[model samples]
Target: MSLFTNSNVTCPNCEAVVNMPAVGSVNADRRPDFRDAILDDSFQVTTCPNCHEAFRLAPLFNYLDVGHGQWLAGLPASRVVDWPEVEDDIDSVFQASFGANVPAAARDVADLLTVRVCFGWPAIREKIYLKGVGLDDVTVEMMKMDLMRRLKDAPFVQGTELRVGAVDDQAFQMVWIDAETEDVRQRFSAQRALYDAITAKPEAWAALRDKLSDGPFVDMQKLFLGQGRVAAE
Candidate 1:
């Protein structure tokens, strides 16, 4: 079941406080419109009654799409620096809800879910978009690593990210955007062959793949964020 709780929020534009329904969890299988809203970037948008300023709430909830084989913990962008701790918490939550702690019946459903921890809107949206388009996310992250090395003036920086804005058979539409503000810093296309090449040579990327897939936070950025969480045995 999808759950929402009314919470007070301060408007960024106006100093007015307003109450709104904040999502606690999303069951996309039951409410696909919620999924649609998320894809369209409209989920949890609220208008301040006092000043009528529009503001979006940072995602802080669990999203489950059984048919898509995805189970994600969506968190605020500010919390990404603490991913090690956050990943541990998400692991515990997944365990209680669907891992060993759950009944066998639930475990059957859990087996199909690809668990992930995403920070901010762009990060979470990229995960869902890649799944919907049948793209391998691990390879996609590998592509970003390659791009960082190849692009002479790539705008790689803190609080910004490279995400797949769209994709097709020929190429992936990529955007380097501010994770918090959703501002597009740059736009470019990556050929499908780049992803295909990486997919074809898994042996070369085995060690990096292990590190990226060590936790639910399978993003390449984790590599730059100091010594990350130790890989599970």
Candidate 2:
């Protein structure tokens, strides 16, 4: 069932309060239109009536894709609390909704879904898009780190957004965007050999897997770097 509520929202542009749809939950298979809106980033956004300014209505929401057998709980990062418990609650919800058996690949509840402690909609949208392409977010970050290291002496600034645009068995294509300005810097390719190296290492895969149980913002770069540091020691 589709779950949402219309609430009064204050326009940041003109301060006129208006009612808008605050989506909290969605069963995508039943509500295909809602899923389309989410992927296109239109569901939580509303235009202000007084000033006609567009703004995001970022209430925490749960996205369940029945066809893909995936789910994501998106919460504001500021609401720091017991996330593992929150995940457990989501697990219970999933079981009640879908029954006891989950996919064999899903070894546990953490594997059953994704927990996104998001700063805003863009990050959440990107996560959804990445998963659609069968690329794990943690592994993609690892690739980004390798790209920066290879171009360490280049003129690029720090904090550029590394996004996977396409992937194949031989290579992964990425687009680099300036973090602050949100401008596309360039497009580049990262050898698939880099990705293979990480998945091949049991320790690295285990590091990412273990961190999934703790909380959100997996911090793949930090975890990957920590592994590298340990290896060098």
Candidate 3:
């Protein structure tokens, strides 16, 4: 079920309190629109009426994607009222919605189910964006590691950030932005040909299926690297 609650938010600029709608809870089956909003990267924005300022609102909510059989409980550090009972609460909510047949991805809530802890709006946005692009979060992290390795020899400024951008049939675009100015520094494309070729193998596909069944995020760096690599073998 989709749930929303109004909360009084004090404007950082004017200190004027305004009641705003915050997502109290949500599930994909019950509220696919909320999932759509996140996929569109539109859920992080909230505007203050009095100050007329737009700011990011991080609310505690359960993100359940039935289509993907994925469930995420997002808890930003700033809003934690009770830390002790979080596990029990999350289990209760999950059981209430999904009953006993929980997905293997979240079978062990303490270890694998919890995705974000003390994460900001951007973190949430990145997860949704990557998922939308049919990529695993851990795979993206490994990709980022590879990107950093490639960039180690390149000439760049001090506060530059590299992130995975648009994914296309041809390539995956990696965007480099200036951290201080938040300006696009460069856009580099990494050809998807190699990835496509590797995953085309039966072993690779089976490994991926097993990983996804285990959890939404999977570190496939080892699977694709070394003499013992799945692709090479």
Candidate 4:
């Protein structure tokens, strides 16, 4: 079930206090509109009644979409630096709910779900968008790595991310966005063949796949971040 709680929020524009309903967990299978809101980049947007300014809350919720076989923990981008600890925490939560610690029936459900952790809106939105388009996300991350090598002025930096904005038969529309402000700094498209070529040669990317999939936060950015959690042998 989807859960929301009314909380006090300070309007960043005017410093006015506003009471709003903040989401705790979203069950996209039951309320697909929530999923649409996320994809359209409108979820958790609130207008300050005092200053009439629009602001979006940082995502800090669990998202479940059984139909799409996804389960994600959407966290604030500021927490990216602490991803290793956060990953372990979310993993334990998943285990308690649907993994080995749970009943056999729940564990069966877990087998069909792809568990992930995403920082900020763009990261989570890109994940859902990729799933909708039937794209392999791990491959897409590998493609980004290749793009960084080819693009002379790629803006691959801290607090900036390369995310999939849209896709078509021929190409993938990509954007470089500020993780905190959700501002798009640049946009470009990569040939669909880039994704296909990588998918065709999985053995070549086997080591990379292992690193990206080592935790629920299966993003290539982790490679650039501080030393990530070491996987159990």
Q: After superposition, how far is residue 80 of candidate 1 from its true place, in Å?
A: 0.5
Tell me the spans in candidate 1 whose CA falls farther than 4 Å from its real position: 230-233
Q: Give the alpha carbon lDDT tens digit for every residue of 27-90 in model 2.
A: 7779878766766767677888888888777547877775655576666533323444554565
In order, candidate lDDTs are 0.91, 0.62, 0.56, 0.91
Model 4: per-residue Cα lDDT over 83-178, one tens digit each:
999999999988889976678988888998989999999999999989888887888999999888888787767899999999999999999999
- State the TM-score for model 1: 0.96
Give candidate 4 regions above 4 Å deviation.
230-233
* lDDT value, residue 158 of candidate 3: 44
> Residue 94 CA error for candidate 3 (Å)?
5.1
How many clashes in each structure? 0, 0, 0, 0
> How far in Å is the alpha carbon of 86 misplaced in model 1?
0.6
State the lDDT of candidate 3 residue by residue for 1-233, as single tens digits: 77778888776668888787788766766777777776565674677887788665565776766555466666663333332244346657666655567675545542323342213343455566676677666545545655556665443544454556678888887766543233577878887764555445646455455543242223232233233212325
- lDDT pick, better of 1 and 3: 1
Q: 1 or 2: which has the higher TM-score?
A: 1
Q: What is the C-alpha RMSD of each candidate to the true structure, in Å?
A: 1.6, 6.5, 8.8, 1.4
lDDT of residue 204 for candidate 2: 59
Using all chains and alpha carbons, the TM-scores for the candidates as numbered come to 0.96, 0.65, 0.60, 0.96
Better of 2 and 4 by lDDT: 4
